[model samples]
Target: MQLPESQVAVLEAANADEATPVDALAAATDLPPETVTGAAFELEEQELVAVTERVDETISLTNEGRTYVEDGLPEVRLYEAALEASADADPAQMGQVIGTSGLEGDEVDIALSNYARKGYGSIDSGELTADPDADPAADPEATALESLVDEGTLEGSEDVLEQLERRGLAEVTESTVREVELTEQGVTELMAGVETAETVGQVTPELLTSGEWDEVEFAEYNVEADAETVEGGRVHVLREMSERVKDVLVGMGFEEMDGPHVDADFWINDCLFMPQDHPARTHWDRFALEQPTHIDDLPEDLVDAVERAHREGVGEDGEGYHSPWDEEFARALALRGHTTSLSTRYLSGEEIGEIEPPARFFSVEKAYRNDTLDATHLLEFYQIEGWVMAEDLSVRDLMGTFEEFYAQFGIEDIRFKPHYNPYTEPSFELFGTHPTTGELIEIGNSGIFREEMLEPLGVDCDVMAWGLALERLAMLTTGAEDIRDLHGTLADLEFLRNAEVTY
Candidate 1:
């Protein structure tokens, strides 16, 4: 029975013999376009008026198109030039004709090619000639262009529109326009007249202070209407996964190891028995630092031992690599390629207290590699590294550890294949079948630390170590098909918001 002033005004203007566009209605009512739009929508919702929308495609000239209209289309110019020439004029090369037409680059080829296709001209051996009946003044395209310039739109076949679009002569765009008209019910309601009341959407301080709030009626709200989303605070999913991994490792009696992301290659590679000339130690695989190019804190004694291991084999019956060893390369600063570097640091006893026999150490930390990004691999990612130091560890112990480790995450089907690593002997690569792809994806690398690798670190016991992918684990556990979907810019916000963290 009661309507706002804006709604009543819009309804009155729309009560016409024919539907009127929103803009026209606004003009007739002397109301702002935006105000008229809102009022029209409200009236429609009340079934007092009907609103219909139409989508129109309009063509307009771009900067280059305007220039063509001022001069002439490339094909048209070429055709005119050919027509003005002598009937028996020397056959003009397509290029020369286009050049005479003032068209160059892609426009030259476009003009010559389309001239023949449009039946306006013919091209012979590198020559161009106009059709005897060709006339630029009567060209349909020229007429279409003139019409577009005057009316700002073209009513033509799809082929005509596509031709102009392909030649970069015009741009086509779509616009949606709405029209409003009163319904039969609206006419009846208007005849009875509309009455408005002082209704409050919110109680203002002035109204409360003046004690006038109780005298006015408040508009009823549609509680079921959609509201803005409010996201509550929670730890990031990656951080939560990190915490869960830490809990699993700790539960398995593994003491967590922590170290710097940037470190000397001495501990990361040299102490791990990696040859100085190894490809992975090169710039392509390692991120070498510019500032502070070399770390000076490496222990002198440890450096000497690692240097000897590279120059000379570890134990009896060994032939070390004959390649030259450079101490500077060993001391070069770089981002750690794997958290196994931390394992090397801890086993060396420089940090995380002294490494004793029967030691179980693991590091769930970030590592940087000079890697190309893809659906699965990231340049920087979390690596799950763990090492167990015992009197005499075997490959069986390594397999068992992985079994129990993945078991915590409900991954039971794990298989290992013999593989090779620079630091670990009897090496094996861990694999798990992808749930979606059904392909066996490599999870990580593991093997027993060779004497050459352990001796330099001052660890006399047999050490079994493994480096696994944390992202792959997250993907498997959380049903993420793409590893990138778990983190980084490409991650889906909707998926992150609704993704339930698996225990």
Candidate 2:
């Protein structure tokens, strides 16, 4: 049968009586390893040869290991220095001799321990004395390291390799090596003589026009062969979902709002009725800025109102926390923990001119938190914050808005648990049933702005607002179990390439 030149060469080079490693065959045939591997796979498919793969663990020296070899092992240097010292030499500290031998810090301890362990010397009465007959050639570790540097690889006792590994002198890695053998059919075929003519895998226009295709052999095409996957450039899954969220909010008659990621604590906490002594305001939860300690140009009247609300409370039946409110603390700058700061800015008329009742505003922007990185929590993430300032909005309005908002992303089963927030009265924790796991996952925290929270911002109307986690929303729609896979450094590229865009 006609075969490609590469395949024919591989088959002829294989020994009929025994298997040959792909590397050995490549060397003997003077062909590239990649070419030999590809031909071996093709020949195996035709039942002319067999391919076997074995994983090999190899030990090699690291840069530090090579340096130790060049400078002589720490123990060896210590031994030689102890041997060369005068018999009347002052009693020497083992550490000092190690130091004199060019060993420093941990190296000194390492050399002393190894020197004693090898029975090459004794450090008795703070005096170091080397064994006169302790031959350097008796050191196996030193010999092993030098051999590894020269040979580039070594196969030996795993215990020896592990000991070297623990010292940070070498590392062990696994590699798969392919071995090929001529099968009975391959031997029979080779004995019958296989053709080495070039086989065209693809028909060319020139060949078709010249009619040379009829005179040449064509390679057999295997329809079942796997091909490389092609991934075209596409929008990041998170960006696509963010745009979709904006589109849905806009469709619901909500105008988009914008705010600074770095802003004064007055707007982030004070305007939201969160006291300066609150735990969430602590250094553990919030990222305080070093520069620009205080925000400038804040409205004096609004600042005083917020301060009074915190110190003395406002309106009848409004008993404040009675905590002394420091305006300086309120003016201290920090990274905003939530986009609700944006809603606070807009509702207080500090951002836009005036906020009339029955107006809707939303912001999908990043917020920072001093949080530990995990599968679900990120140090920084996007928040979907929205607020409706109406004269008589109720809890039902908040629930209905969440239902409609989640429905836009194909989520229908949303349950709310009554929870408490410093700024929201009768607050709720939003939960959605995970599409893949089927377990309910808390996705957001929200509630109607309490009278205390709203009054400090000069808003008399009831404000129904919610701050939802955009990453959690994307996870449910995209079926990603780890929120990190949506946008974090650990994001899966394959998931992004195949993520469904419908939701």
Best by lDDT: 2
Q: Residues 274-317, candidate 2, lDDT per residue (tens digit)?
A: 98889899998999999988887789999888888887777897
TM-score of each: 0.65, 0.63
lDDT (tens digit, per residue) of candidate 1 on 182-289? 998888898998876556778899989999998988754544322345887766667778888889999999998889999989878888888888888888888999
Residue 281 in candidate 1 has what lDDT?
Answer: 80
Candidate 1 whole-model C-alpha lDDT, 0 to 1 = 0.80
Worst ten-residue run, lDDT, model 2? 220-229
Q: Return model 2's CA RMSD, one decimal.
A: 13.2
Counted clashes in each candidate structure? 0, 0
RMSD of 1: 13.6
lDDT of 1 at 460: 92
- Tell me the lDDT of model 2 at 26: 90
Model 1, residue 274: distance off in Å is: 1.1
After TM-score superposition, the amount by which residue 362's alpha carbon in candidate 1 deviates from its true location, in angstroms, is: 2.4
lDDT score, candidate 2, position 371 = 69
